[model samples]
Target chain A: MSEHNDTFFIGWSNDISAGLRRFLMRAAAFVVVGLCVVSALLALSITDPARSLFGANAAPDIPLDVTLRGVLSSEPYPFLLTVGDAARPAGHGVLLSGDGKHAAVIDRAALGGQVVEVKGLLLKRGALDMLVLSESPRVLQNIQPAAPAAPVPMGRWRVVGEICDGKCGAGIMSPGTGIAHKACASLCLIGGVPPVLVLTHPLEGRQFLMIADSQGRALDRGVLRFVGMRVAMEGEVERRGDVVLIKVDTGKLRRL
Target chain B: MSSYKAVTWNRNKLIYDAVAIAAVVLYIQVYRHFGAMAGRDGIAPDDATLSMKAFGSCAFVLLSGILSIGPLARLDRRFLPLLYNRRHLGVLTCTVAAGHVASVLSWYFAYSDLPPLRALLVADTSVAQLAGFAFVILGVGAFVILLVLAATSHDFWLAFLGPRVWKAIHMAVYGAYALVFGHIAFGALQDARSPALAIMCALSAATLVVLHLLAGRKGAVEDGQFAPTAATTPWVVACDIGEIREGRGFVVKLPDGEPVAIFRHEGRLSAVSNLCAHQNGPLGEGRLVDGCITCPWHGFQYRLEDGCSPPPFTERISTYRLMLDGGRVLLDPRPNPPGTRVSAVVIPQAHQTPVNETSAP
Candidate 1:
């Protein structure tokens, strides 16, 4: 009878120990899960970029077509244009315009020998009449065009003509002022005409005369009032009619 | 055995991880200074300005790491342990962010005509100023949350608030995250020249969106729980036989579309408001780590049993009892009077070992 009791006690003890082991395992699993949760929370607190778990955002595309315009002076454009894939620093078209009365200039300081191609329509201030446009302007590039002549011949002269029509020489006229008699004498000696002035040079000066047409195109409405007034005259001669069309050489023009 | 054993076991891992991160950050900062040296001549003539930029880069890197932790955690469960130390990371990130702002202020204060205080906070100075204010706000908010979390990251708070309420207050981390993200994007990321930085920002932002989407889907699935009314009766559910798992938390849907996040711990499964009390973040979708079911949206943590604040924190949420019958989980939505303790009902199925049995032991 005592042996039977001992066997029953051992069985009961074994069952209790098994139950305890099961309980511990279950508890360990919970603890593992709990650790996971706490770790996740800590990570979120540290790295939560505040949007979503994936850090997604509403970064919709926005259009950027802004343009600015200013005088081309020695100073370059104030805004910086990110250049190249690496954003290498490069100069822009502000400083290049510094000479005289130019509309724009390209600052060559930051050019870095990298080709800069500036192209686009730049709106002018308060003028709807004419627009400034540039085709792809490649800067800092070396491209051969043609060979140059050793030394070109050039000369200068003055020719005169009357202001027969239109707004020619209009700037020379005061309210009631005419070319004063003395003024006409001096202007006639140089190359001054009522409406036109022509430049000429000895046949040796050809290059200066070639630039005369370009200079003429620049002065459509403006009159060359001081043409015969001891003005510099240097260009090849192109005699035509009684006008003595002096195609002046640009290199040797001088007041005489 | 003391409950502290489980909590303290992973402390070394936490310290080691923290040290490794610090080393990486320091290395990055040193490497960045070298990069700055290469570009020094081409940059502006101001030495001070260049130094500030280098410092800002370090701050940018730190903030990026913090923002990336969330998506990283989601991608791999191995990172689940980072949650307990996230508050410390927050402090570090905010410090770096704040330092960047300070440098900007100093640079501007000396060079620009604007007053120092105004330069720091007012948008009138420049876009940079507006962004600075946003960063500061985000930093301050994060600091507050971190201070609270760090102070209360112990068992004492768990014993006091009983887990429910404590979990609710700590959930503010989500709001702080949103603010910081915007601050970075508009402030530092906007000025970034490197494609790598842009890519990082884009990826981080995308990760956040994906996580939100997944969590939202989970919310949709449990929308039947909480009603729209503010004073609607709280939800209750009882565990069904063979439904509780020893380690897994299950979802309980209410009639109204709200869900109850139920965790089976300590031989029982208890339910709490599935919607994160802060920002309605779906807690049911969150994972369990370190005995706390962390809200996936912001990272708020609640102990496994007796929903209460862990320690040094004062927050609470509603708790419910569970029962099981015929393999169906049942919950009682009615509130239990304060101070009464009840363990969750969890039955480990693997232990049953019987093929034909229809019930859990």
Candidate 2:
């Protein structure tokens, strides 16, 4: 606490000793550069790419309106299975959502198996694709003996994965899933945006599945607590077109 | 400290503020542009998320620097300039923290079914669970602490609230810092991939701890040295007159542990409480300014003879009677009433030769 030196610093005084001034300038510069380095390091380290929806220019807010022709299914959730065109051989099984975190409202029984035209804003992350409905869809063509939007049942088994809201999982927020996005994911799931079980490891070329209850309806809200956490669930995995649907037994879900 | 009604933005204060603001801007820009790397999956983060990271990290770094200043100043006299106008840095830190909150609300909770504030409060209600507890609560708590401290940072609050009360409240900054540390450790640390954050936080925290220990040890040693020899007598021989540096206060602690600083300025010796009236800073380390013992901590000046802040500044400190008993400075352990005028003891003619005249009065 003692400095036996000639320099006396009076803060209010305008004049500063040349030696002290030099020391302060150098110190300030050093601190500033040091902070920049810290901030840069923290920013780089914390925001993970796997969690971000739009990582590496994957997608920005969809600019052009998107309309897809597909067969609608209503049992588990309102989703469209688009038929492929010349430019694209592999069609998409994109979940349909409504404005602001809610799932798209479409009469399941009426549209089931019927070919229809769906239009909405598209939100896409890796594997998960969602088309948010701008308006109610219309039947483009209803052919007799409609193509059954069949889901091939792939026998019951135990699976481990993190449950996340499909919309965010697809890429709404930069990082749309994980512990940080737990509350948001819960909100979206509550709002009826379909939940998905993102497998900890890709099982049989499948990374995720649209999650449903054992009866094959939208998932229970009680499971929201487990969202963004690693959890194990016993469920019947069904390969539905390009996507997989897991009919999980809510009773068997447990944190891992 | 002058009349604090209109904050005197001195050249140093202005320059300090400018540099701080510039640093903040530089840190944020660096974070936005260079910090984010394109992982194989997506686009740049949204403004809201980017803002959160930018402001949050910037606030953290600023807080670390702010907390480091006190101990750094003690460990080395050269670092004292950083201590000057440090409140401005604190205010800026609070401002940046608020920006983090604003960005969070705009993005994370804005789209939720629940109201933004409600979502913020009840969003992640895993308070019962240790693994996923409500870390946002810690962040909010720290923000509140920072807000209170920042709002009352002005000298007006220091005067109105009284230094003791004001200082007590400001000391809560350590608690706020702890809360912030917890907020990051639990919140970001849980989700991050790289160990950079954990490492940086550990280093910053360790640095602060080490600095405080070093400074505290130094002060303890200094305090132990000035212990009075006479327990029976009211008067204790403080030190040799030659030992008291010219234009500086030399501290002598009484038997009761109360310290009195004996100052030698212009061949005359006077004594006052070693504690500065403002913030209880170590006035003993300070030198005489315009014949007033200026507190090294904040430049608060008290007249040598009468411990009153020279007219127009009403602050005062307790003065002590000094005597030149055969060149060995004798101190009356009992203190004179604050502002009591005690005549300065003139040094013997043989010891009156001035030291350096380079420093201003």
Candidate 3:
């Protein structure tokens, strides 16, 4: 009986040894797998693209329609222009006519006071146009020289109304143009929030719409909340159909 | 005299068990790192899927290795020492499989670029990704079985469930193994280009087949050793009054070549199949505990008097009719319906022969 018991003990020991061997082999396999995975991850990190993923805030270079409100001086021969400021530097303006680049630019002092419209090619060099006057510039927008000479009292007029046409309803309010809707759509699509749009339109009363970009950026800049506020304005006015263009010099806009 | 008890414990197996578990955890960490790297490369979805495949395949390899260790030991007793950590290997395999499932789901939801709610719903749906769904289900089932087995591994559960019930429920590990194996064969091997994976699969299948064949051969060998009747043409007396030792069983055979195991406990004898139902492990070479026989291969137990398992497990084994002759034991080869109780026979210790010799000189 003792011999039998001794044999059983030996068998049990053998079984235990087998178990240990299996355990060691399994452990080794796991270590190999782990190391391989780590190496792959490191490789991926070392080879990623950097510049295009980060530097997206630079302003676009291609020309787009820009309208700013400012005071115009009636200068030599009823030239409609704004008072020169350092920020708005003077530049050589090329008049776009039937002949192309043939028109000349008048000096800023010559067109400082007269409330009139002068449309040509807008060249970016300094504050105002700084050259001798040449041919007559075609007026495509705003008040013409023969239209209205009576200054309608240079105090302050609250903006009674504003209407956004074309793609302007996208929530990107840029003073007096029409390209706000695309930006608003991008914000809505990405961030899942809408920017509040407040604008006083002449025909449709004051309206407020939550604007969102298609990518969902939303009202991150926080500049659209004062759309209905009263602001003092001093600029030569021009009306093309129902859209009024106010090229103003400066104004104190206080929220109502 | 210390009873000359032959119960030797292998301490080295415990160390090996710890090492295997640590290795599996380490592999999982590596797999996760790879997944992260893949994601950063703008290939998160592919990385996740590949990682899951790797995990499942790794688990299958480990499990097959663990299961095969027992049969390898028979080829050399020196290898028997490795068997101690087999259960740990199994548990570790299940854990790795669980991690693979989690990683796959996370990647599916994260990189599919769907809305969170939509991702969750789509993950549950079995469209366009049948492999993922099947893998998840298999992994979940294996995890549940592992949890139960791990919880009940203590001696307390052995004493609480009285061995028979515990062994029966634990047999589900094999079922889990089968499911996971199918999941990998159908899913992972599809995209594998490595000859290593193909070799591993072939080796796993061959090892399983060889191990089962050895177990069946061991059963036959035990039966042959206890011939019981050389003169009787059809009937044979399997055990003797003194041969059915306490805490142990003996495989006996009749002239018809039918095999049965006679278990002895508290001076009583009852018979069951020599083949364990769980993995076809030889029951005659196993230990008798709490009035049941425990298969030495994986510790599955069955009641001797009646084949029914304890509560919460409904598996049963074939029982044989035992008759008491003049100081000898006779067994009918044909098995009675499972769960039917048979009369017990008192077996004396004088005629019993020891199965193995002591290691101590």
Q: State what share of the real interface contacts each candidate retains.
A: 0.00, 0.53, 0.04
Error of 1 at B233 (Å): 13
Q: On a 0 to 100 scale, what is the lDDT of residue A116 in model 1?
A: 45
Whole-model lDDT, model 2? 0.79
* lDDT of predicted model 3: 0.45
Q: Which should have the higher DockQ, number 1 or number 3?
A: 3
Model 3 regions lying over 4 Å from their true place: A1-256, B1-13, B25-54, B73-85, B111-168, B223-236, B239-250, B253-361
Clashes of each: 128, 12, 70
TM-score of 1: 0.41
What DockQ score does model 2 reach against the true complex? 0.44
List each candidate's DockQ score. Answer: 0.01, 0.44, 0.03
TM-score of 3: 0.41
lDDT of 1 by residue, A35-102 (tens): 33432322222211111111111111121222323211111111112232332222222111111112
In lDDT terms, which candidate is top? 2
Locate the minimum summed-lDDT window of 10 residues in model 1 chain B.
Answer: B38-47
lDDT by residue (tens digit), candidate 1, B26-138: 53344344433323112211333343444444444444455455554445333333443554555555555555556545543322233555433432222233322234345
